[model samples]
Each structure stands twice: as structure tokens, then as C-alpha cells.
Target: MDMYIRVKRSKSTYFIRCKPSDKIIGIKQKLEEIIDQPVSDQRFVLPGTGEILEHIKTLADQKVDSDAVVALTLRKDVNEFEEVNIVGPNDFYQSRDADDANW
Candidate 1:
């Protein structure tokens, strides 16, 4: 069955038509394509619990129905930029400390 869902971001709202059996990651990928954001950086907020929707689940598994509103926010790390300390050209790999593993 096809479901129409409303995705609300900061100020923009997107209307998407999907299937109940569709994976959440597929939805995130579509949103990423439309909004120029990466799927890894996207978070879908649940209505009641304020919980994030997991990508492994399908729309039906999440109890998301037709005309459902799915709130979206960027992951915390998405907006955060880590400072990189560049050493010599050949020492780039060694320059990063253990604390900068994420970088």
C-alpha cells in the first residue's frame, strides 16, 4: 500500500509517497537526494516518544501510516566540525592523535 508522509525539517516540509514495506534507509536516501544531505546525517524523530527511527525498520514495522508526519533533524555530529591540525605533508597520518579518531 502506498503511504503519503510529511517530513518536516527546520523550516521546510516535504511530502513523500512511499510503500509500507519500504525500508527507512530508502526514505532517508530519498530525503538526502532532495535536500542535499547525507543519509548517515539524517535522523527521523518519532511523534510521541521523541525517539529516533532506526534505519533497519520498515514503515509498517514502525507503525507509520498514511499521512503521517515524520520530523527530521541532522545528527549531532553532522553540524559539528572538528579542527584538524596539519603537520608535514608526509606526516598527515601520524599527526592525528587517538582522540581524533573520528576525523
Candidate 2:
């Protein structure tokens, strides 16, 4: 029988279905496919306790049942920031010059 579980990441939740005998790594792979992120960058944890889900254990070993919820977080090594353009004080004043000229 296939077991179903809900994985919550940030504000999004994903429902995954698999066999109880399936390894945790398999689930992580499925999550990678869904989220378009590598398994190495993913961290699965139990809700509330912050306990990490073991990669070597199966769904059965974890006692995961249908509709159970697991929390997903990015690994520390994964970059969380995106490239952004910073506006320095000089740049801000330069851009404001045009508007200031009209005043």
C-alpha cells in the first residue's frame, strides 16, 4: 500500500505518496524533482521538534503514516540570497537630482 505524507517548505506544502518500504532518500529525490532543488540542499525535519529525518531510514521505520506532515528546509551551505543591486548614498543622490531639479 502507498503511504501519503505532506512536506511543508516555507509557506508551501507538498503531498507525496510512496510505499512504506521506500527509503527516505527516495522521498528526498522526489522532493528534489518537485521543488527543482538538489537533494543535497534539502533538509527534512519533523515538525515542532526540529529533529532531522534520517536519510537511511524507510517511511516505515520513521512511523510515517498517510497525511503526516514533514518540514523541509534548505541546508546551511545553500545560498539563500539572490544577486541584488545596492543603491549607495551617491547613487541615490544622483538619481534624486533629476527630481530635485524640477522642484
Candidate 3:
């Protein structure tokens, strides 16, 4: 089945459409297109378990399902990957539920 992952980095979020059989490298490639960072400079992690996603593995192999939250980290000048830094949505957007309250 097709799946979409939410890739987060700092204050930006990328909704990537993918398949279970798609490799982690494919995801990196997608990110590279939008972030202007090479695949070699990109890193992905599961925020919940802090597990690093391997480029050679498929999404199914990593148990990354639809709507999964994957954190993106990029290599810095020192050649070290930065820490996961995802920013939550602003309070105004979370003020009320869409179905229960008016915008």
C-alpha cells in the first residue's frame, strides 16, 4: 500500500508520498530535492525510539508506516549531523478542533 511520511526539520515539514517497498535512500532523495542538501548529508530518525533509518533498508523493513513522523538532520560544517530539532505547530492552529469549533 502507498504511504506518506511526515519529515520534520526545525520549523519545516515535508509530506512525502511513498510506498512500503521504497528504500530509505529514496526518501533522502526526495528531501534532497526540496532542501537542497545531498542525500549523503541527510539523516533520518524515528523520534519516538531514536532509531536511525538506514539508507539500504526499505520503509517496510524499518516498520515506518503511513503518517509516520521522521526527523531530518543535516550534516554541519564540522561534518557532524545536527540533533533533531522539530518545532511544534503554533498555538493558534491548535486552539480548537476543526469538527468541534469554527475557524
Candidate 4:
């Protein structure tokens, strides 16, 4: 069966088409094509619950259903991964307005 997930970051949302049996790493591989970030540098979390998805785990194993919202965080330095920072649409509008003010 085909399922899709929404992977979100700051001001960016990637609608990834996947299967329930797919490993978390596989999804990260797909994301690499779009974001150019290696799987080692990427981390996925369940939005709200903050449950970290393991690379060896499948979507079904993690109870991730169709249309689930997953937060994508990247490694900042050496040891720690950055916090989830999915920006909303309003932020874009506000930032654009702020940029216009500078013009």
C-alpha cells in the first residue's frame, strides 16, 4: 500500500510518497535527493510527541500512518542534532514584510 508523509523544516514542507514497510533510512534517502542532506545528518521526529524515528524502524513499526507530519532536524555541529524548527506560513509572510520594510 502507498502512504505519504509530510516532512517539515523551517519554511519548507516535503510531501514524501512512501510505503508503510519502508525503513526510516529509506525515507531519509529520498529526502536527500530533494534537500541534498545526507541521511547521517538527518533526523526525523514525530511532531508534537517528539518521538525520534529510528533508521532501522519501518513506518508501521513507528505507528506512522498516512499523511503523518514528521519534523526533520539536521545535525548542527559534531554531537548534537538541532531542534525541530518547522516554520509556519505566517512566518514567511511576516519575514517577507520585514524584508520589504528594509527596501
**TM-score of every model?**
0.71, 0.70, 0.84, 0.86
Error of 4 at 18 (Å): 0.3
Q: Using lDDT as the measure, which candidate wins? A: 4
Deviation from native of the Cα of residue 9 in model 3, angstroms: 0.5
Global local distance difference test of model 2: 0.75
Off by over 4 Å in 3: 90-103
Query: Residue by residue across 1-103, what tens digits does model 4's lDDT show?
Result: 9989999998889999999999999999999999999999999999889999999999999999999999999999889999999988776565646667763
lDDT of each: 0.77, 0.75, 0.92, 0.95
Could you tell me which residue pairs clash in candidate 4?
none
Name the better of 3 and 4 by TM-score.
4
Question: Model 3 — which ten-residue stretch has the worst lDDT?
Answer: 90-99
Number of the predicted model whose TM-score against the real structure is largest: 4
**Candidate 3: residue 38 lDDT (0-100):** 94
Score candidate 4 by TM-score against the native: 0.86
List the candidate 4 regions with Cα displacement exceeding 4 Å: 90-103
Model 4 collision count: 0
| lDDT, candidate 1, 51-78, per-residue tens | 6688999999998888987888775674
How large an RMSD does model 2 have? 11.1
Order of models, best lDDT first: 4, 3, 1, 2
